[model samples]
Target chain A: MAQLSYRDAVARGIAQEMRRDERVVVVGEDIAGAGGVFKTTVGLLDEFGPKRVLDTPISEQAILGAAMGAAMTGLRPVAEIMFSDFFAVCWDIVVNQIAKTRYMTDGQVSLPLVIKTGNGGGLRFGAQHSQSIENWAMAVPGLKVVTPSTAEDVVGLMAAAIRDEDPVIFCEHKGLYASKGEVPDGEIVDSLGTAKIRRPGRDATILALGMMVPRALAAAEDLATRGIDAEVIDVRSLVPLDTRTILGSVARTGRLFTVEENPQLLGWGAEIASIVADEAFWDLDGPVQRITTPHIPLPSADSLEDLVMPSAESVASTVEKALQS
Target chain B: MKLPLSEHRYGEHGVVLPPERSDANDALDVDLDRRRQLYRSMREMRTFEKRAYDLFMKQLVKGTSHLSLGMEAIAAGFGAAMREDDYTFATYRGHAHTLARGVPMTPVLAELLGRANGLMGGKGGSMHLTSVEHGMMGSYAIIGAHLTIANGAAWSAQYRGSGQVAVCFFGDGTTNIGAFHEALNYAAVYRLPVVFVCENNLYMEYTSIHDITAVPHPAADRAPAYGLESIVIDGNDADEVHLAAVTALDRARSGQGPSLVEALTYRHGGHSRADPGKYRPSEEVEAWKAYDPLTVYRERLVRLGVSEDELDAIDASVLALVDAATEGAIAGELPSPESAFTDVWADGGWSWRN
Candidate 1:
């Protein structure tokens, strides 16, 4: 195993897929010659050449439309939307066309494509650039949504997403781009709809997604020192949620807490909280708690941004107070 | 919110129209068999649409359907010009384009009735017709979106050295949509094999396209900005459309990049079954109806040395085909309840759980 940054893992994963399947191609703004604006797709243009790696203009609809059309005809295209916030510019392509085409065509056509975007806040990119809009994609019926917190999951999940028959929204967090983690050397393809039990415990269950996974783990470490054992679960894929892992953890701890970076209203955690309330009602020792950014646009100030998003300290305090009471 | 209407935007001559190319077929070069095929395609489309109108009157048609009542020549012309492997992406008023791809009338009609034997097993309804086997890629209901999607198909063809062109057909109003311009610029930049066909049928639903649009010819006028040739043709004449389609198709197939063609025609009927088009003046309707594509094409066939007896035979056969298809479509049963739960995912199940 070698330690790789989360951004480098994205390039590694795409290179693996492109080398394996000739049909795989990448299209986005500055993704080809420039190696992507975030530098997540470096070394791809040199390895795969311009034929496999393409750079397009700032037309989100064109980028996605070309990707959708290519997928329908026969080419596995991995397109980028720059920032998750820019999905609004071409939501018609995402929400109405790409997401609905397979089912609307009644399975005659399948789109095996991936739309990777820089998602979430804390980098001070302000409101337009940094919103955790996984909930937006999750609301659509025919889309697969996943966000990886670690480099290993990034390489593995991107492979799984590109190989899947459906369209996947791969939300790569900008906040975790510089973070490092160990990734297996050869091809590593993980499964979708499966959650990883980051930290196993017995007192209470903590569920987190994307960048929140690492924070939740840190929160678990913080709570352990306070004598409150916490089980931290990484909710990797949202559409095909691993209820087996979540429900099993809930049953063991009899208490649930969701740590989310998304805004409060209709956050992904809201859905999990609802699910736990319905299925694990008898298993609960207290009310299900959701620690999330309040329903407001992300601000650019470091202190203000930190105040809005759920942190390791906030999660620790929330879980401790709930478990102790 | 209400906006003031200019005096130039109100009467029989409210919309500025393209000049008629009355001699569009002066030097047209189509052989005997090809002419018959074009005539037959337009006839089949006309019959299918009339049958759909009848079914709607009977309350048997499932949902809102847009028809190509007088726009058959555009579909027939491009469909004829396109190679068998070439892709077609059309708008919601796509029954003609779908039929032009040689998809049989029975399943197409059945799909309109929401029947089990329908093309999509009654899931897509009248708007979203798609047959991947025949290369009728999809019929998008939303305006301007498919133009961008068509670029992808063309881009894929270019990448794989398939030598296939994607012919995307949409109404004139689609030019104003944000995606239309983006798609044009994208296709030209990559030199992808795509042809954008705008069926300028004078109206954008109820509003006159010319009044709302900055330019008289919405699509062709925008071509220079994208470095494509601006082309406008007589859509009522199959010969004119076929010749133009061939030029554009050849341009795209040979990697000369994309071409934009605006076909000038008039909708004889309203936009959909729900509209009677009382908004259009009777004189204007009558004047336009005189240039009916099928009638004019049949007359043109006689002038081109094809006898009336041969034309009559083709017409009789088309009527019989439509009659049989209507009967077959009516005989199909409602889709099973279990079908609703299927096809939501590639696994043929709608499970979102682990």
Candidate 2:
């Protein structure tokens, strides 16, 4: 085992998949020689050569369209969008074409492709660069959306995504890239849709994803010291959500608090809250709570950004509120 | 991944066929045979579309379809020009193209009727028919989306030295799409083995090409700006279309580079099942119908000694085939809703893991 950052884990996963299958290729703007804007694809071109690691033009539609064709014909492609906010430029392909091809083709074709992009807004990147659109991804039916909070989950889930015979949106939070953690060697890891329990507790359940997972874990630890005994569940995958795990945890705790970086209105937290209410309503002692980002564009000022995103203290307070309610 | 053949020719003879302006009067015996085959294919497509419309009126089919009634010659022209192994990417109006490529009328009609035996196993209705066995990559419903896909296939073919060309079929309206420009630029820069065929039918729904694009004559003209070889042909004439497609295919296969062939044509039918084309002038429709591909080919065949009786027999036979396919489609079963979960992935095992 070795210490690794989220960015490094994503790189390792891509490198491993490339090594395993010659058909696996990486394409994005400046990902080859420039190592990607976030350096997630650092040293990939040199290791895999130009053919396996291509530097594509800044046309997202062309990039996605090419991946669709490549996937249909047999290549397993991992396309990187510099930022998740840029998905607007290629929505037609993603929503209308890529998401519908499998069902439309009646299983004749499988889009064995993975699209990777960095999201979230804690870095004061402003509205365009800082927006967290995880809900948009979750809304699509055919795509499998995975959000890994730790360096280890990043490597594990990304590897599974590349190997899975379906289109996957492997989203990374820009705020978590440099956060370090222990990463085990070898390809052995957890499956895609299974949520991991970060901490076992009985007072209440705190469910979170991506950057929010760390905050939830920290909140759980802090709550434990105060006798709250909050259980922290890291939702690694969103689309094929681990509902069973969440529902079971909610059943045990009799309370739930979901955290996310996106705004409170239609954030993925709303989906989780609704699921718990509809399926495990009787199991809850009080109404479920959600600690989420402010329902406004991510401000450019660093101080304002700090105020907008939910921190560990905020999540802990929400869990305490849920427990007391 | 070398292609099955490096260079293909008409028979064993090494005679060079005329380029855009093929020897009009000095045609070879093989050329005559090729033209006859082209006529037959176009006739079949024309008959198929007409019958499909009739079926739709009778409420035998569900959903809507984009027909290729007036553009039969373009399908015949391109289909005859390509080799069996060459791939084709078509748009929503792709029935004529698929029929000409040898997808039986039965599955296509079955698809329109929402039957499980349809070409896409009834999954893809009219707009999304795919026949992998016939080298029909699939018809994309998105306007110009397939252009980039075709470019990628061409790039792969070129990279592997396959000598095989992938032909992408789109419409005049697609040239306005960013995908078209980006795809053409890539094809030009890489010199990929791909032929971009624009069946410029003039109208994208109610909007005309002249209203949307600055250069409307041959969308192929835009190709030359990207350093690709471009040609404009009479899409209503099967002979002209076949010659243009043959030349483009030859250039692409020989590693000369990519070519754009714009076949100027018109759709006699509405855009889809419900489009009555009230947006356009009646005079305009009447004017285009004068240049109907079927009439032009029929006149050509009659002049060439294929008597009226023989032509009637061909029409009757095609109509009979269409009727039988429609009846079979009506009798066929709808896909089990359970099949909805079926092709979501390549294997049932993969879905289970998720």
Candidate 3:
């Protein structure tokens, strides 16, 4: 095991995959000589050379389209979109081409490509840069959405995303880039569609993703002090959702509170809440609560951004209200 | 409508076809067998498309189908020039392109019919036909989208030292899209081995290209901007298209970077089955019909010592093949409802139902 930051873990995962397979390539803007904007792809160019680590023009449509094409051929491409907000620019390539290619081709081709983009609203990057758009990815059918919370999970999940045959959108939170945690030194591949129980409890189950995972964990700790045992579940994969784990936790706790950094209306949290309500409605002791950002663009001011986003206090308060009901 | 004596034409719009070399006489040095094969492929595509048009008119084929009635020469030429392993990508009007790439006629016909035996298992209809085994990468419905994808394929070939080139076929309208420029820029910068073939069929759907685009020569005029070598070919002449494709593919394979080939042609049919092409001028249509690729090629073949009976026999054979394929595809079974859930993911664990 080794202590690594989330960014470093991502770089290590990509590096390891590239080392193992010559067909694996990394392509993005400024990912070559300058490392990535977030330094997530640092040292890749020097290690893999220019052939594998290609620095492309500032065209998301071209980058994604090329990556899809390469994936169609024989290359396992890992493309970075700089920020998840820019996915809108390449929306056609992702939704129309990438998502539909496999199903449209009837299993004739497999797109073993990873689209790594920074997501979430923290660090005051303003409206354009700081939107957590995991909901958009989850809404797409063919795409596998992975949002790892910790450095260790990033390592495992990134490895798995690189190996997945389907196109995987790895939504790395910009807030979690600097966060440090222990990651396994060797090969670690986590299975997609599995949720990890961070803090096991019985009072209420808290399902969180990306940055919300740490906040949920903190809220669970705070709830423990108040004589309430809150179970915290980190939802790593959003598409092939680990519904079994969430349902089992909800059955044990009899209460559910889903948390995410995205907007409240039609967010990924709502999908989880609806699933729990439909599958385990009778088992729920109270109505499912969702703690998410307000349906407004994230502002540049830190205070306003904080107000819009969910915090540990907010998660704890939501849990308290659910328990009181 | 008569064949020009000079073998070169420079229009006021900057469209230029270079004069034929004196060293090359009668069919650009292509052997008789290859010429016969090209003629057969073009005839097959033409017959198949006409039959498909009738099927569409009868409401037998589901959804809208785009027919390349006047653009078979480009597909046949590129298909003949490209090696079996080289990848090919095209726009929605890609039935001829796919057929010329050597994909079996049954699956393509079945796909248009939306049967279980279709190329994409009835999932991808006429617009999205793809056969990876034959290097027919995909036929994208979206304009200019597949150019960058083709660049990626070229990059893969370059990276793996696979000695393979990727050919992207699009229309003049596609050249105006942002992806077209982006793809060309990247292909030039990376020196990727890709050939961008523009089938300038004078119209983009119901609208004329002149009304939409400011540039007269879309491919040639734009090639220099992206640092690409450009050529203009007589699209109606299969021999000219084949020679141009060979030159471009050779430059790509030799690591000379990407090039653009603008094949000036016209679509005899409408953009899709729903379109009647009432917007087209009657005189323009008549003028183009006189230069129909099949008719022109047939006359050239007869002049090149191929008997009239032999050409008729070839046409009959092509008609028979298309008939067999159509009958088999129409008789094929419909896909099970359960199959709609399959092939979405490779792992096979997740289903659309969940």
Candidate 4:
């Protein structure tokens, strides 16, 4: 295993997939010559040639719709929607057409399409460009929502997304792109609905997703120092959520706390809480606590933004509250 | 002045039309079988539409069904001419296209009945019928939504080196939507293999086509502007519709380019079962009904040596099949409530959140 950044891992996965299959091609606004906005598709234009690495028009609708079409016609197209927030512009292509094509066709046409975008709020990028709207995508059925928390997860999940016979919305946290992790030299992790245990514990369970997984781990370590053993679970796939892992972890710890960067009202936290309440209510000794951003549009100020999203401190506080209850 | 014939020949014919063989004898030889198929397909669509109208009135179908009764030739002609592997995207009133492409009537009827055996596994009703095996890409209930998808499919075909084509079937009103312009422009810019078959039935629900748009023609004369070939045909005539489709399909398959076929047809029934076409003038409806594609085709077939008994036998066969399918559909089971969440994603499984 070698250490690799999220950006490098994504580039490697895309390159590997393209190299493995001639049908695989990459299309985005600046994916060709400019190597994408974050350079995730760097050197792909030169390595795979122009046909395989295409720079499309600024229209996100066209890029996504064309990707669906390409996938339907036997070509595996990995389309970049730039920022995750930009997915709003292509709802007809992404939600109505691409996601539901197979079911609509009675399982005849499989849309092996992947839409890659960056999520989460940080880097002082402000609201519009840096909102964690992954829950919005997860709300829609027929779409596989994924947020790889680590570089290793990125390589594995992205390859799996490309090869799978369904449309996958592959989200990468912009904050986690520079975070380095040791990825298996070859692709190893490739399950769709399985969550990974980032850190094991017994006193309490902290279920998190995307960039929040690492923060949850940090909080788990901090809680361990205080003799509070907290288990950290990374929800890699949002749509096809691994309920088994979550319920298993929740059963061990009678108390549960969920953390999410999304808003409080309808975030993944609310979903997780509801699932536990509906199915594993007897296993919980106390009410399930959820730590998330306020249900308001993200503010531009960095100071206010810091308060808006769930932090390690907020998670620990929520966990402590759960323990007291 | 009459247009000069091209040097190109099809099946031992001399150059007649630039895109098609112009020699009457040679063209006749090649088009005989195609013409017969077009006639039969259009007849089938007309029969299906008329039967559906009867069923809707009798309350055999729960939801409203859109009948392309008068405009049968356009769907049959263009759809039949498509290559088996080529793609087709259509609007809500897409039953005729699906039938022309040979999707069994039983599934279509079952879908109207909201049965599990339906095309969309009972989720989609009359408006969203789709069959991938026959290349009938799902029809969109939202007007003009399928245009972009069809354009994408065409571009994909070109990208994949399949030499296949795509046909987008939409009503005259769809031309005014943003998707139509965007789709056409994209297809033109990339020289995508596609045909835009605009069924100009002269109304969008209750509104006449003239009231909503400045352009008189459905596609207008925008073909040259978009750098693609364009043609307007009498949609009531199966021969004319088939001929136009053949020309467009040939151009698309041979890598020449895309074409915009404006089929001037009329819808005999209301937009949906709920509307009795109250907005249309009685005289206008009467005038268009005189040129009923089904009747016109039957008359032509009579002139071509098909006896009245033969036509009756064809009619009986179609009616019996439709009746059987309708009965089967009504008897079919509705999908279980648990089925609501089954097809949302692949079989790996996901948690539901209210």
Write model 2 residue lDDT over B1-354, tens digit each, in one string: 111112212122221111222224234233667767877788788878888888888988778889999998888988998898788899988998888779888888888888888887777899998887787888899888898888766766665567778899998888888888888877776677888888877686777766666764537658768986556766777877777788889989998878888777778877888888876666566766876877877777777777899878877777788778877888888877776676655554225222
lDDT against the true structure, per candidate, is 0.90, 0.81, 0.88, 0.78
Query: Model 4: DockQ against the native?
Result: 0.33
Interface Cα RMSD of candidate 4: 3.1
- The deviation in Å at residue A135 for candidate 3 is 1.0
Query: Which sections of candidate 3 miss by over 4 Å?
Result: B1-27, B349-354
- TM-score per candidate, chains pooled: 0.97, 0.92, 0.96, 0.89
Candidate 4: residue A287 lDDT (0-100): 87
For candidate 4, give the docking quality class from DockQ: acceptable
Q: How many pairs of residues collide in each model?
A: 1, 0, 0, 2
Clashing pairs in 3: none
Q: Write the per-residue lDDT of candidate 2 for residues A59-134, one digit (tens) a residue.
A: 8887887787778777888999889999998888888888877777777777899999998878888999987777
What's the ranking of the predictions by lDDT, best on top? 1, 3, 2, 4
Candidates 1 onward: DockQ, in order? 0.85, 0.50, 0.66, 0.33
Instruction: Kindly report the docking quality category of candidate 1.
Output: high
Using DockQ, give the best candidate's number: 1
Instruction: Please say which candidate is ahead in TM-score: 2 or 3.
Output: 3
Model 3: what is its DockQ? 0.66
Q: Which ten residues in a row have the lowest lDDT in candidate 1 chain B?
A: B1-10
lDDT tens digits by residue: candidate 4, B137-256: 878777666777776688778877888898889988888876677677767766778888888887877888767677656574555667765566767767767767888888888887
